[model samples]
Each structure stands twice: as C-alpha cells, then as structure tokens.
Target: MGKNQSSKIFSPELSCTARIFTLTPHFTQADHAIAGLAINHPQLVATSSARELGRHSDVSEASVIRFVQKLEYESLKDFRDALKKELVNSQTAGNSSVSTQPNTPTEALAQVVALCSQALQMLTTAIDIEELGRAADALEKSTCIHFFAAGGSIRVAQHAAFKLLRLGYPAYAQSEPFSQIAQASIVQSGSVAFGISFTGSTKSVVDALAAAKENGAIVICLTNFAGTQVTELSDIRLITPAPGGILAANSAQTRVAQFAILDALLTLITPRCEYVEK
Candidate 1:
C-alpha cells in the first residue's frame, strides 16, 4: 500500500480492539490506555491531545510518544496516518462478510473447521517459544511452584499444576485472592510462581506476582496479550492470540492451548517418570 493508504489504515478513528491489535508489541502504556478508552468512547479520542488523552486514559504524555514511536512511526503524525488506513481496511472487511445459515451439516462442520483453523494460526503467531522455555526452566528448577489464576484462566492454572505435580514436582493451584497473595509473600527465592490471565490485566494476579517477586521467586505468566502489565512484572511471559469478538471467542480452546504447552514442558522435563505413578 502507498504511504497515504497505509496512513489511512491506522487512523485514530479505528475501533479500540483494532487499534490494539494493529499496533501491539509496539504499544506503550499510553497507547493501550488510549485504545482501552476508545473501547468506551471512540469519537472523543480523535480530537484528544497528548495531555488530554493521558488524563483521560490515566497514562502519561511521555508514554504517548513512546507508544507512537514503538509502532515504527517517525512521529505521532506518522502514527496517526498509519492508524487511519487500518481503520478503513477493517471497516471494509467487516462490511463484506455476511453470516448465512448453512443448509447442510457438512457445510456447518466446514465452517467450524475453518474458524478453528484460523484461531490456531493466530494462537501460534502470538506465542513466544523462548519465553515458554524460560518458564519451563523456572518450574523445573524450583523447590516449590505456585499457580494462581481466576475466572476462565483458573482452569488452565489448575490443569498445569496437576500435570506438573504428577510429574513429581510440588505445585500448588489456588485462585483465592487472599490465599494467592499470602502464598506469594512466603515462597522462597529460586521457587516459581505462575500466573495465568488471558488479558494479562488481572490486578490481583499481578499483585500476587509482585509479592512473589518480593519474596525472591521467579515469576512466569501465560496470557493472550504480550507486553501487558502482567508481562511487565513477570520474569517471563508467554502469550497467545485472542480468538476475537468476545461472544464468539472460545476461551476453552485457549485454555486447551495453555494446557498443551504445559504438557509439552512436562514431557520434556521428565523422561523416565510418568505423569502418574503406580
């Protein structure tokens, strides 16, 4: 695409989610807060200033400039131009897709397969293998491992802890807010604390990681958003892509992916030992 076209694609008028996806890994704190605000109010974001956007989004002006430059733009002007193009393309794509009821079972199955396949592609694209390896190393070497998560992510945490424990590792799974914090406060250094959150924005989990850090434990995070607050506080962060459109998205599949990752780690860590012993 030409410079002008690219500029229009990333314009400030884009939807918050789109803006986030279009410039992720490259976003600074201010960019994310601004994108989050657009989720609540899109139009006002268009006319907002650095200071105004910062105040409204609760981020700093310096962060706004950092966010822009991170997206590979020469300046905020270039960033805005790129955003415009992204906005235009997204609208164009959405308008062209029409959901139609399938006339046959085979057709419906085909549609399901296509969507899952696409989701798998996105999940793989977002994962960082090196980060996963680091997390595995922490878990393997730790004297004690604590896993904490809430909501949909709790299941992933529980399952991972189970598999790891069965492989002869002492891993605890808890979602209780206070218990998580308490456990983190005491876990010794060289131990591991794993926190799971799809958005990587769960305050309690983040706090728990902080406590674990203060106690000298290595912290690892499994999340769908890279470079989020959770990642910032973690020793290593593993990410996966969101399935998109909250209502249509399948958290189950994401959990399954996280489980698969844990399974792989267990397999690598234990050769003679089985996950379950007689």
Candidate 2:
C-alpha cells in the first residue's frame, strides 16, 4: 500500500478492541472469529502461534494470518509482539504489592493504604488529560447522560450520576440489567453513556454501551484494561490502573481509583455550571 493508504489502514494508537471495531465492517465470518479471540482472549493471542490461534478461534491458519494483516501487522510475530507489549504494560500498570497476611489490624490497614496509594499513582500516569478534557466536554454538552454499571461498580455509577445531577445535568444510573438495556437502546444524539467496568468484561455494561453506540449516543468507557469488550464499544475510553490478582477484584483500591476518575471528571465539568461557579 502507498504511504497514505497505509496510514488510513493502520492506527497504531488504537487498542486491540478498537482495531476490531474498525475492522468489523470488512470482516468475514472467520475474521470475526479471529477478532473475537484478539479482543476477548488477548493473552491467548500473545502466547499462541498463528496456527494455534486459528485452531482456538475455529478458523484456518490463513484466516488468522489474514486477520492479523488486516490489523496492519506485517506478520503474526508482529501482532504477537504488540499484544505482548500491551499485556506487559497493563500488568505493570495494575501491579500492586500488599501483604497477604498481617499480624495486626494496624499492619493490615497500613498495607491497604499503601496499595491504594500506589494504585492512585498508577492512575495519575495512565489517564490521558486531553481525552479527559474531551470526555468532560461531551458530558457538558450532553442533553442526557446515563451510567451503566453492574455488581460493585453500581455504587460508582450511582455516585457519578448523583454528582452530575447535582451539577444540573440530566443523568441517571442504570444498575438493573433490563432497565440498562432499555435506556441504552433509546439513547439519542446529544446524549452520553458512561460504562464502568474494572475488569472490562462485564456483559451488562458492554451490551448497554454497544446498544447506546448503535443508537447514536456518545459512549465513554471507564476500564482498567485497554483491549477489552467495553473499550471496543466506547467512543472515549478512560483507563485507571489498579491492583490486579484476587485482592484487586472488587477491592477498595479499585473503588478508590474509580472514585478519583469520577472526581476528576466532575471537577472538569464543574466550571460549566453557572451556579457552581457563581
């Protein structure tokens, strides 16, 4: 391809999920299968060979190669190298150290506080201020705003919605699965939907964001990882690094990081409120 054509075809800054989203229109059945593997099982892609990936994704080796090439990789090794780099970055960003056992409550509290502090530091480096500014602008201009979250994340969604409402924005938090989908389906232009998923694999949030995007809403995603299903559906993605492993799952550290993101977003939008400024 010519330089201009290659530039159009390749987006180095896009995550794996975003690449799949861009390629969806041109995908064959086999391509979809390969893309699914790339999006949902990136670890598998990073570790597996093209042939193995094909077998795992239920596609042929040629199909797997074609899929990688379509993503603008010169070869399977190139794709795997990129995926491995991304995985390493995510692992490093979300990595935290906390004592598995503590002799006293003081020790436990100290460990927790240390972990949370580290996670917040990671978040400071992970987030893009420019994208955050854009997200704030989107929320400020939105005629309506909706938050999609499930499980423990529902609390974060509720808090964000409440803050937005306090700022005089039309915002709602949809925690119920049915209600989330219903609201997402009807999201019109001039609306924004925020999906919060730490693991980035929450089916309810992903589905709702996808629906909202299809309905012309600007979908923003708050996720821990880049190459996730929710990120693929989002028009804007805000990532926060938190501790990984069992302790990290629904841990206080993750919640705190999420709250920090919410606070930053709210603070950025606060200036738009005449009453608040006055």
Using lDDT, give the best candidate's number: 2
Best by TM-score: 2
Model 2 C-alpha lDDT per residue in residues 43-83, reported as the tens digit of each score: 77889987799899888998987888778777888788887
Candidate 2 TM-score to native = 0.65
Every model: Cα RMSD to truth: 6.7, 7.1
Q: After superposition, how far is residue 146 of candidate 1 from its true place, in Å?
A: 0.6
Quantify all predictions' global Cα lDDT against the true fold.
0.65, 0.77
Per-residue lDDT value at 231 in model 2: 76
Q: Pick out the ten consecutive residues of candidate 1 with the lowest summed lDDT.
A: 89-98
Q: Could you tell me which residue pairs clash in candidate 2? A: none
